[model samples]
Target: MERIYLDNNATTIVDPVVKEAMDPFYCQMYGNPNSLHSFGTEVHPYMKIALDRLYSGINARDEDDILITSCATESNNTVIKGIYYSLIRTGRKSQVITTQVEHPCVANSCRFLESLGTDVVYLPVNEDGIVTPEILREYINPDKTALVSIMWANNETGLIFPIKELCKVTHENGALFHTDAVQAIGKIPVNVQETGVDFLSFSGHKFHARKGVGGLYVRKGTDLPTFMHGGEQMASRRAGTIDVPGFIGMGLAMELAVRNLEYEATEVRRLRDKLEDAILSLKDVLVVGRREIRTPNTILASIRGVEGEALIWDLNRSGVAASTGSACASESLESNPTFVAMCISDELAHTGIRLSLSRFTTEEEIDRSILVIRQSIERLRNISSR
Candidate 1:
């Protein structure tokens, strides 16, 4: 049986070009960038090229601090906890704001802060699965709220938030803004200067770069306390030797993603719509958000009377890779959190499944997968009915 991959949102296969670019660093120029010896110094030029790619990919300025970290989880922890240590712990502020639909790292970090007496407000999303500026204003305590962390694109639903407008609101309220751009970076154009976000977190694996490498963008002169200790690496904002090979590949991947963003918006989106149309044509199935509001390559659909896990298993057996939701919590046996946040019906919430595509997802794969998906769903629905 031929296999088709439709789980790019959970993680993407590394691009072969990126792999080829990273291969030489392992044995050829294997050296710590911090070392002054020839081996280490030999990699500096390549490192500079990688850094330049990263900065240009996101439109970050020269003065901004792009600290390389282990993953988006670490980058997120650094931002949330850094704010606590920098402002909240200092007694200058006591509250933070985030949406109820944030990724686990951001959501759990806020919960941790709340345990320490910090007032954390989780703003609710509307039925459209979005936190409107009006809702933000209703809950924003301007005098006390120090930071507002929102994701640029939701991991489960792939809904794109109005980061530029939200950042403006947060700034007007005198609070710093942060966005988890893990899902948005490669699929959409991200300009930190235009959005005016104080901090942004991104992961490599989401965009065809190898896993275990990510970065945090800190605007110039932002006072974020160090999240790690014991080393002066990453300008002392983060400690530990960098993953040179991972970063190199990630930098190239980012550049490629940005360069081919138009293709993603066009071809990838067309295939996504074709897949969604097939799913929606079935009885009692609906997509989470309108296509206009979501990233180009994602589809979150709910099939009534069918269990999400059962559908996923059925699809897997048919040689199609799909997801019930975020891979971070895939094994938890829980309902779709995005549906829950959108106030979807309990019966339908448990039936949600996500199918995400990537630049490499070809038309032929989508065509073949559509037939398999339809067969899987029909079979599952029949069994559930019986």
Candidate 2:
């Protein structure tokens, strides 16, 4: 049977062009960028060129703002921990504000800070999965508000948050605002200057890059505490010898994603909508992220009478790949709290499945997926009726 991949949100297959671009980095120029020796320095120029690729793609202002790290998880941890510590040491602020819909990385990071006696507040999001600016402004306590970390785009439901507006609110309250754009970077247009975020985190695999590389876009002169403890790398913000090949892969993947962003997003949105339209037409099925402001490439639906894991397995058997929620908690047999925060019914939350598309996804694959889901739901219904 032919296979169909609808799980772009979890990860995408490494694009061949991205792979081809990485060939020489590992095989030929296999040298640590930190070394001053001729062999090592040889890759320095390539790394610089790659930095140009990444920075230009994201429209970052100063080259100093981009700091490479292991993944978005590390990027997030660095930013959250760094800022929290920075504020505490300077007696600036003591409270952290975020939303319930954040990726587990951000959520857990906040929890960690709370463990350290730092105050943390989880502002609620609307039913459409949006954490509105007004709620943030209402909760803002500048005297104790250290930072506000919100996700620009939710990974599970694909709803795009209003980062720019929220940033304006947070700034008015005298709190630094940050956004985790791991899912938003390549799919939507991201401009650091335009968005006015103090820190932004992005992962390579979220776009077309390899798994091990990601970056934190820190606005110039945004003081923070240390994350990595080692010799010079990422200007000591994230210490350790950089993975030259991984960064190179990240650079190329970003180049492709940004260069073709408009064309890719438009096409993927068309395919995503077709799949969503077909699935929601079935009895007792609801598309969770049906709100107008949701992400273009994300289609979330709930099919009653079936567990999410069971649905995922059944779809897997039929050669259709999708997801229940965040990859960080994929193996857990728990319902997505993000959907729960969106006020989805208990029955539907357990049944939620997310189908994310990519630029390379085709109409035929989407149509095939629609058929597979219908069959799987029917089989599940028969089981339930018995």
Predicted structure with the largest TM-score when compared to the true one: 1
How do the residues 217-251 of candidate 1 rate in per-residue lDDT, one tens digit apiece? 99998889998996888878799998999999999
Model 1 C-alpha RMSD to native: 1.7
Candidate 2's residue-wise lDDT over 1-386, tens digit each?
Answer: 98998899888887888878788987788878777898788988778888988788878886447888989999999988988779954677889999998989999999999998889999998766688898898888979898999999999888999999999989888888889999887788888788888999998988887888899888877887669999887777778889788888888888888887887567877778888889879888888755467778997887888777788899999999988753233566555678778877766667788898988788999888989999998999899872
Q: Whole-model Cα lDDT per candidate?
A: 0.90, 0.84
Clashing pairs in 1: none
TM-score of candidate 1 relative to the true fold: 0.97
Which candidate achieves the best lDDT against the true structure?
A: 1
Name the 10 consecutive residues with the lowest summed lDDT in model 2: 325-334
Write down the TM-score of every candidate. 0.97, 0.96
**Which pairs in model 2 have colliding backbones?**
none
